[model samples]
Target: MNCRTSLSSWQALTTSSERLKKQHLKTLFDSDSGRFDKFSRHIPGVLFDFSKQLIDDSTFEQLVSLAKESDLAAWRDKMFAGEKINFTEDRAVLHVALRNRANTPILVDGTNVTEQVQSELEKMKGFSERVRSGEWQGYTGKSVKDVVAIGVGGSNLGPQMVTEALSAYADNTLNVHYVSNVDGVQLAQVLKKVEAETTLFVISSKTFTTSETMNNARSSVNWFLESAQDKSAIAKHFVAVSTNLEKTREFGIADENVFTMWDWVGGRFSLWSAIGLPIALYLGYDKFVEVLEGAFEVDEHFKTAEFEQNVPLIMALLSVWNTSFLGHTSQAILPYDQALHMLPAYLQQGEMESNGKHVTFDGQTVPYTTVPIIWGMTGINGQHAFYQCLHQGNVIVPADFIASVEPQVALGKHHDVLLSNFLAQTEAMMAGVNEEQVRNDLQSKGKSEEEINELVAHKIHKGNRPTTSIVLDKVDAKAVGRLIAMYEHKIFCQGIILSVCSFDQWGVELGKGLANNIEAELTEENVAYEHDSSTAGLIAYYKQKRNK
Candidate 1:
């Protein structure tokens, strides 16, 4: 693979900061009456309205051309066909196959991976049914009443986010808990809630050797054994989603209890794979299937839909327009529903970890930015937090406003208030308060001329901030699945547009490797290791204080 370093026209447009500064989203909308029809896309129960963004038809056309120049279609096909598109690891990026509802045959090596996916899904269904129906019992002959999922990164975030999003749909037969943080506080908190005898642990690690995951797994095992009273009982209570059967056996999980994860699946995209065991355990197997089916629907749309009509492609192009053409440095994922509170964090890892690269596929430095710093909280909470900056900040920040028409928890007028805020924020962002409006409002309040001038300056909002509103009919298992897959595909498209590999994450490895060495040093009290000046000083200070 040769390094590609040429800037796309979209990149060229954004290179001129002065040009971007002069363009306003409000002007873009005002100048075009069909802007909403041109920019918005709908598929199934989801509506993505990007008309409030700063881009016009010509800009969008240029983005489509950029996608063509990047050969996005070819890359998309390569991924679906199970080709070795993940160049860094020499693996096929085939998480799409995890939800292959068409049951299409996909091959990795000579093996039909679709068959393996189906088999694993069947295993998950059977296990989920037994556990949810009280047919699966622990060594103590008690039906499992709680689940503790132990994984890090993609393993943890995807399932945890989905389970939380679909919490209203949960049968409540068993309580589902997730432990991802390496901090002992996370594990200790979970241990205090569930009885170890009736708790089942789902350990998810592709290699079964992720340092944080394994450390947490070890702590969880110890916590379980404290109640079970026998190390042998670990086999009955602990299950694994990993291909490393040897490591799982060594860790005391029975062979039958060990599920499989494939190299074709990337961690962030593995929720559709066996990593979704926690989701199924929480919402029953049928709803879990609904999630997969929903994702498959998006998969079909992404694979078959044209560039102009494609929801994911439009989203990807709009992001490029915002970050590369409009000079926006960060993108916000603002979900109105409380159940989807983790979405921003989940997408932060999904988008940033995937496409936050400086280099293209062939090791050449990219001429433009790849991924924006994606961050946000739930919508109502954000209004009280950093929304002031979003409304009147010096820089333009593109935001995605997600809300459901129907609330999951209909607490009287709470949902209406939430929805009103959601609708009003986007409207305010698009149509900011002009100096005249501010002055008039001040005058109407009987302010003096000088006082009105002072207040107007602070009240005048440059309301051309770009935002996309994603309104879902509801947030069920299927809706959550479609929503997540929409972003996943959008991330993929953004990577393709930026000429970077979306599937590989070598960036996360450096810290994990260093942490292992640091952990060894801490445990052994080996203070002789060379380190950065800041780190050395900290370790020295800690060791001296401990010795005192």
Candidate 2:
């Protein structure tokens, strides 16, 4: 039987969860003075403190056993070797190859992806340099001053998040805009701000046929032609990052301007590839390379680190321990830095979309839960919003609190206050205020017994909420890169342990295929098709509103 069915570690964790229910974190901390040191790890430029997580030494050892029994190391080796681990899609999960900074040869189907990645990097560097140096001209013989990147999902989110997250590192030489929405309002607003004379459009789509991306690209072309008034001028103003070279060339993007995206790299994880052109354009190619180098360093560590000391593996195991064994259904990712505001959302898609599966590799329905509903906002804001539920609610939501030790922008005492809140919140979650402590404070304040009795229930907080605090040395391009790669590896480990395919997202496609048919009907008032009762009623209501 598989580990899911008959693993000794699984039984151990199940029993441990039951036993720990009666124990408070305060008691556990009292038992070990060195819990923090024992539970945390300091990597190159980041420190991960999992001390707040509800795990003792025995639980940690069992998680390690889980990894060992699951053959995690062997599976990881298979992924790094570029084997077709994405069995449903028959594709190699090689996003690691995109940022192989050491120029190490990674073979996929006996072909070196590293060399191709280097070639693309060199091309991107050359092209970005030419544009930056005013060598690349727009349709009207002007240097490119603005860039509008058009793509959705991985193409938009990853690159946009990185660029926005690392805005301080940008040169401000170019104004970069992104339009991922299918709605015309976003595209129109972006186009209205930039003149066609000096603007460049980067139409990124792996297939060069994504519905939203192609629509936006076509609209952008029409918008540009309003000024240039020539179809031939399209080549100078537009470029593409797509594998469908034939489609891109037919669309008038020059051969040189059409970059590549391999099938081995999924869109959500393609920021290290040419999909990160906006990042390179705004922050310069060198900084972009720094991001790649940061991720590469983590790749090396993840590849070689032992299970006992491994960061990503430990994180994955903790997630499994919390979600599967402890019955927590959702995880919160609260990043403390303002620069990392997008971190939670980016990770939402990265984790949920990757590992949110209901079936095993052989299509057997899973008896246990897989990925959690990942949700959170900036740490301070979340304290005001959903942190209440995380603290006192019935659901046990394990969270990862990410913050930087050094402020990216040193503004007076702001960083200190942020850091204080960061440290305090995690501590508060772990060691909640008891009624005894609340009553002691109330009595010291000279509150009468009647007033104290009324307030006690509201003031009492049951602690032992689990958390992981990640402290980055600082929020730089490299640190952000390392941070993202760490989570990617964690998701990989998570899927492997859950007996699910992490790389395939057939669930996402089901909606898209349905929407395609629905779109055709929406365009024709008289046309209709078979539909569910709720869907049919909804469509009728929409058409009635439209006709009116």
Top candidate on lDDT is 2
Q: Pick the candidate with the highest TM-score.
A: 2
Provide C-alpha RMSD values for all models, in order. Answer: 1.8, 1.2
> lDDT of each structure?
0.88, 0.91
**lDDT by residue for model 1 (1-548), tens:** 32323546645545443464677767777778888888888999899898887766666776787788778899999999999998889999998999999999998898999999999999999999999999998989999999999999899999999998888888789899999999999999998999988999999998899988999999998878888899899988999999999999999999999889888788988999989999999999999999999999999999999988899988988887777655678999999999999999999999999998888777888777778999999988899999999998887789999999998988889989999999999999999989899888989989999999777788899898889999999988789889989999999998887778888877788888887777777668544667999998987788678778
How far residue 322's Cα lies from its native spot in candidate 1, in Å, is: 1.6
Residues 411-436 of candidate 2 have per-residue lDDT tens digits of 99999999999999889889999999
Lowest summed lDDT window (length 10), candidate 1: 1-10
Supply the global lDDT for candidate 1.
0.88
Poorest lDDT segment (10 consecutive residues) of candidate 2 = 1-10
Q: List the residue pairs that clash in candidate 2.
A: none
